[model samples]
Target: MINDDLTHTPSTDQTTPAVATPDDRRPLGSTGLLASPVTVGTSGLGTPASADGSPAAGSTAFATAALRGPNLLVDTSNAYSDGRSETAIGDAIRQGGLPEGRGVVTKADQDPSTAVFDRDRVLRSFEESLERLGVERIPVFHLHDPYSVSFEDASAPGGAIEGMLALKEQGLVDAIGIAAGAISVMLPYVRTGVFDVLLTHNRFTLVDRSATGLLEEARSRGMGVFNAAPFGGGLLAGRRGRDGKPATYAYQAGSPELLAWVDRADELATRHGIPLAAAALAFSTRSELVDSTVVGMNRPERLEQVEALRTTLIPDDFWSDLEALGTPPSTITD
Candidate 1:
C-alpha cells in the first residue's frame, strides 16, 4: 500500500540549481560536457511510485513536471519498469512544452547478457527509447552501471561499451557516459578520458563521501559528474507513514549504528532549521565533485522539495558537527 504521509504531505519549498555563473557553466568533469546544475532523474517517470518507491497520486502530473523543468537533464534506462518509464518520459516531452534540439539527457541499458551489443539489438533499443520519448537522439546516452561492466563484456561480439560507441559513431548519442555505483570502477573510466560523463550514485551522498576522491579526479580530468541518491534512499527526508514505516522503500534500515545516525541527523536538522535529506543534498552538491545532482521526483510537489536546496549551504560548523559525531550512520561503500 502507498504510504499515507508521503502521499499527503504538502510540497515544500526547494532550492533551484545554481544558475551557471561563468565558472559554474563550464564542462562537466574534464569531458567538456556542459549541463545545468540540477538534472531530473526519471526513475519515477512512468512508475506508479516515486523514486523513493512510493506511489504517486497522479502519474500524468508527475511526468509533466519532469519534461517542463528548467535546464533539466532527464535520465532514463530500458530497465526501468521494462520501458514504461521511458515511454512516459517521451509522452511528457511530446505533450509538454520542453524545448527541442537540446531536450533531455538519457541513459541506455547495455546488459550484454541480453546480447545488447548486437548491432540490431543496440539499434532496436535506441530506436525504442526514441519511440518512447519521441526524440530524434539522446543528448547524453550513458552505459548504465559501469562497475559491473567488464572489458570482456564491453568488447565482446555484443558488449555494452561497443554498443554505446556504435551509437556515438552513428550520431544517435551526442555524448557517451557510464552510470556507476562504485568509485573504484568510475575512477578508471575518468582517468582513461574515454567517456564524456559519469552518473554516480550512493557513493557521494549524505551518508558517504567516498566519491570525493573520484569527483576531484573527474573535475581535474574534465569529465562531468552527476551525483544521484543524495538522500540515502529517503532516510534523510524525515517522512514516515502510518504504522511507523518509512515513506519510501529501502533495504531495511540497518542496526544501532544506523538508528543512532538517524538520531544524530535529527539533531543536526533541528539545528539547521531543515530536514536531514535537504541537508544531505546541500552537502552533496557543495562539493567540487558534483556538476549536477539528479533527483527523482514523482510530482511537481516533489520538485518543491528538491528545489529547497537553492539556499542551503553546509557551513564549516556542519562539517565539524558531523566529524564530532563520528562516521555518519549511512554510507555507500560500493
Candidate 2:
C-alpha cells in the first residue's frame, strides 16, 4: 500500500514463522535514513533536576541504549514538558554519543505563551530545539500542531512552512515533516508536495483508524509515515497510572461504548493467550503504510516490555475479530 521502494516485513499472523520485531531497519521514505520500526517518543521524558540541571540517570541510560540500536529514531517536540523533553533527550544523546544512521527527530512548535505559529516564531522554535537538543543539525524537523495558526498563515510565503523549508535549504534539517491532528487541516498541508514526512498521533490505532487516509496518502507520495500512540496512550495495553488508575486515551476519559470495544479486544487477546499490547503494536508495524510507530517509553523497563510485546505472535483471526467490533461510538474514546 506504499511506494515500490518501501517494503514491509512479513506479518507473523500465526501462520508466518517470524515474530514481529523492531530490530529490522528500513528506509524512512526518501530521506536516506533507515530507522527501527518503532520510534521512542520523549513526551514523557522528565525535566532536568532543578538542583543540578541534569536529567535523570535512568533517562540517559535508556537513551544510550536506544541510541546504540542499529538505527532507532527518537521522537521529541519543542513544547513537550516545556522544552525539557528535548533537553533530556539531547543530554542523553550527548552523554551516550550519537551513532551514525541513528536518527533524532524533533518538532518546531508554536510559542506556547503567544500562540504564534508565524515564520519568525517557527524559526525561533527550531533554533530553540537545536540549542536544547545540543545538535548542530537535525535529521528531521517537523511543524508540530499547526492548528493554532490558520491554514492561510501557515502556508503563506515567508510563513511557518517557508521557515521549515529554509532550514532544509540551510542543511539544518535533512527532512521537513508536518505533524498534526485534524484530518481536514493535515490533508491540505499534505497536498503541498514539500513535506518529507508526516507524523499522526492518537488517530491511527487499533480503536481509531482516523489517520488511515493520512497514512495512505503519505505512503503514496513516498513520504515517511509515522503513526504515533499505537497503544492509544496505554489504554490498549491496559496500563495503569502512578495513582494506580486506568490509563486514559490522550489524557482524556473514554466513552463507555469505546471501553466496551477495548474490553472485547482484551478478552479476545486473553482467549488467544497473547498480550493485548502486542495486538495493538502489530496493528501498526504489520502495515506497510506506516514507516514507523512512535511509542512513549519514559523508563528503561519499557525497553524490555516492548521487546516482549513485539515477539508475541498473534493470529490473523484475532485481528479480524477485533476489527469486527468496529469503531466505538462517540468521540474521546480515550
Candidate 3:
C-alpha cells in the first residue's frame, strides 16, 4: 500500500531553504537548465520496506522540502517503488508549489521481472512518469538501467533510446540522459553522443573513484555528469558514535576490502573532527566534472544536515591527508 502521508498534500511548514536563483544557478551541461550543485534524490522516499520486510517510512515532508528550494533538481525514476516516488513528487508539488525554475529528472526503464526493453515500453513508462509528476513535459528524461537488459536491444532500431529521442524531437523532453550502475555498459552510449546527461552512482566517492574515467569521458563529450551516492552508500553517511551497520556498496553487501576502506575513512573523520558524511559529500561535488551531486534523503532533518554539509568548508590539508590514505587506481583530474 502507498503511504497515505505521501499521497496527501504537504503542509507549507515543511518547506526548506529555497534553491539558488538564475544568476546563482550552475549550468547543467548543454541542456540550458540551471540547477544547484546538490540534487535531491528521492529513491528512499517511496520504498515501503527493505528486502527483509522491515518497515521503511516514506515522507511527503521530505519531498516538500526538496521542492521548496529554487533551481533545485529532484531525481526520480519509474522503477523506484513502482512509481511511488513520482507520485510523491506530484503530491508534494500540488501541496507545496515548486520553486521557480526547479528541474525534475525522472527515468524510464525495462521491468525487472519481464526484461522488456522496447519502444512501446519506453514511451509508456515515460507517459506514466509524466502523469505521476503532473507535468506536460519533463526537463530531463533518462533511460534508466540499460545494463539490466541487453544494452544493444535497448539502443537498437525501434528501441528505448529511439523512443526517447522521438519524445525529445516532439519537445516532450528537453534533454535525454542515461543513468546506470555499470560503467562499461554506459561508456559506449556516452561515446556515441546520444545523451545530454549521464548519472553514475556509488562508483565515485571518498572511498572509491571507479567512475573517474567515465566522468572525464562524459565531460569531454559535453555531457552533464551527476554523481550519486557520494557517501559510499549509507556507510559514510552514518553518525560517528554508532558502530557501523553492515555496509552496502552499490546496493550489495560490501566486500571486506571496501569495508576496510570505510573504516579508515571513519578513523580519518574522527581525527579531523569532521562528520564523515560532510567530507564524502564535499569530495564528490568538489570535482569540476560533476555538474551535480545527488544525495538521497528520507526526512526533513536529513535535508538540513545535507544543507549544512554543502556549505561547510574542509581544510586543504584534510584533502591531502585523505588522498594520502589511498587513491583509486584511476586518476581523477580536476
User: Which is the better candidate, 1 or 2, if ranked by lDDT?
Assistant: 2
TM-score of each: 0.80, 0.87, 0.86
Q: How high a TM-score does candidate 1 get? A: 0.80
Candidate 3's displacement at residue 182, Å, is 0.8
Better of 1 and 2 by TM-score: 2
* Residue pairs that clash (backbone atoms under 3 angstroms), model 2: 249-334
Model 1 agreement with the true structure over 1-334: per-residue lDDT tens digits: 0011122321222332222222234356654456666666766455555576532335545556645555456666765656666766665566654554235676665544653444455566677788877878777877665444465566576666667788888887778877767666666656766677877776676666677887777667667788876665566566444386643323344456766677787797779676666677777667767888776665566656566664455566776776677776553445
Clashing pairs in 3: 18-69, 18-70, 19-69, 19-70
For residues 294-325, what per-residue lDDT tens digits would candidate 3 score against the true structure?
Answer: 88766665656677887777777788888787
- RMSD of every candidate to native, in Å, equals 5.7, 7.7, 5.3
Model 3 / residue 208 / CA error / Å:
1.2
Q: Whole-model Cα lDDT per candidate?
A: 0.62, 0.74, 0.73
- Model 3 weakest lDDT span, ten residues long: 1-10
Q: Tell me the lDDT of candidate 2.
A: 0.74
Q: Model 2 over residues 91-187: C-alpha lDDT tens digits?
A: 7667656765677899988888989888889889988988887889999889888978888988898789989999999888889999976678788
Clash count per candidate: 18, 1, 4
